[model samples]
Target: MSGRWWLLPGTLCTAEVFEPLLGALAVSPQQCRSVRLDRPAVEDYAAELASVEDEDIVLGFSLGAILAAHHLDRMRALAAVLIAANPFADTPEKSAARLEQLARISVEGPGAVMAAAWPALVGPDARENPAVGNRIVAMAEQTVQDLPAQTELALRRPGAEPMLASARSRALFITGREDPAAPPDRAMRAAAIGRHELVLVDGAGHFLPLEAPRACAEAIRAFLLGRGQDRS
Candidate 1:
């Protein structure tokens, strides 16, 4: 259990929009931690990330992947779980249309819902790289007044496809390919729940690590070297 890379930011993100996947995962040799959740109400922002531990290698994004699929089973030594352009739930009217789009982006604000979620979070060459779309819309206008009340507490939590339907960890669902917010059919129904792996950067979108941070840090360092993780 020697892996430790965290970096989870999205939804009016910070940590400088994961500064190019933390500088291409700091040329990974392990140990890369850069977390941020400054309020998007999943029980008061994931209860201050309840001391993030348990094997570590989370790497969430977009509403921090619904608070890392609800605190990834109490952070139980997670070896892999890297959802980027996040979104889950196959139906129930798409989780009630994502809770009516988080109550219309918390009453039409978060900079008009991040200027209507920046054309579904850049691509087309990172929206022609105006310094990567003005540094990811200046980190979504510096956390656009707390992302519509933390996206209305993550659209009233509990929908990462039945909380990662029978999750055995070791998952990956990074997306983009013209992501109009969690596109790619919401990462193919969140990679058919559990035991997943589905990347689609090809022309990026939905902030794929601020528009392709070295192809989202080499697809999360090849999913932490296909879950072997030691890398040494």
Candidate 2:
């Protein structure tokens, strides 16, 4: 098991989103450190991420995964585990859609946005659970105190392909089979381009860490252990 790790949570998420997965992985809090999206500029985010030691493991989720993919070369050892990653570039159409989302957040409030996003964020099984949906909404609403600023940080993220290609061997991508936002195919595209491993959890959605913690943890363990074996 790795002794230290640097965790990056997704947009509007605190390190709390990682609690379930970390518990599932049997990693102690002392061995882990996490960062939030306080910085507005992408460069600022990268500058802050540089604090991670070369030997420490990285585990990033969603938007956090996208950031990790761009900054892969910074870490010299222990491949990053990027979960529910969306490595695609931002297109004009996509940006426009996001603008609409931002507009909605302004008019209807963050809770309304979270309501619309909940079903798409989880698979059918998780959607059926009131507790799961409620928690996602609550967490998103709580952590996203600065909703507009947090939303803006992810607006113009550059394509991750070029960045990942240089440090292809230092990353692994994991995604949910049913994830509409970052499906298996998208993760596969990244894995293929980056020349890294890809793991797809069955019946999972964008929130794999919470939806299927055991499966997510198993894949992370296998990647870390198997990668170690490869070096041996």
Candidate 3:
């Protein structure tokens, strides 16, 4: 039987952000679907995902990962992948940083906020590639309008460490080696709590799905296939 996969995009992102990765995975036998979160809160997104009836593999990127971590207990997925997300315990510094970014967005507007965040979101190679860079920027521009509300929701999101530690489903954490927003070191620590495997794509940045779609697809494919074999 073919496997089922559900993808969740990051904060302020539509399912469009996963297009490249989804296209890369098209040849796989697994059926892939991307969940578009219209609401901003982690709980809201989690609730939507939890409502899905089918047993599938869930892959969440950034904010989506946070949501997945928050609702893992309620989800009926076979396995979960948290991509470019910080699912560890919250810290005062992290909260402060988010607030600072929120303040910046409030003052400078969404476009400015996106421009400021672009460096951390895309890798140098992506920026150098005209097509990739333009596409990433366009995606950011399209999504920026939702930044303020999304930022607020992110700040209010509950820490996922407790959920991560006790989650019944197998978990995988994937991050870019060069991702400053969710560094590999931090991702590794977060994955360690759940004994989850961590996969770092060498040349990618925060937007691993777009910047390194092939690598991301390969890692996810291997993980899901291996888990499927174990189950059988």
After superposing candidate 1 on the true structure, give the runs of residues whose Cα lies further than 4 Å from its correct spot: 1-8, 20-22, 25-59, 67-141, 153-155, 159-163, 166-219, 222-224, 227-232
Top-lDDT candidate index:
2
Error of 3 at 153 (Å): 2.2
Candidate whose TM-score is highest:
2
| Per-model TM-score on C-alpha atoms | 0.30, 0.90, 0.83
- Please report the TM-score between candidate 3 and the true structure: 0.83
Better of 1 and 2 by TM-score: 2
Compute the lDDT for candidate 2. Answer: 0.76
Stretches > 4 Å off in candidate 2: 227-232
Task: Give one digit per residue, the lDDT tens place, for model 1 in 1-232.
Answer: 3656666677667756766776776735346676656554556645545655666666777777657776554555464445454554334665576567556766775456655556546778766666765665577667666655665556566566655675546667777778776778666666767646777778877777777788767767677676422121
Rank by lDDT (best first): 2, 3, 1
lDDT of 3 by residue, 19-70 (tens): 7887887834246677655566676665567655445778789877877878
Clashes of each: 3, 0, 0
Candidate 3's clash total is: 0
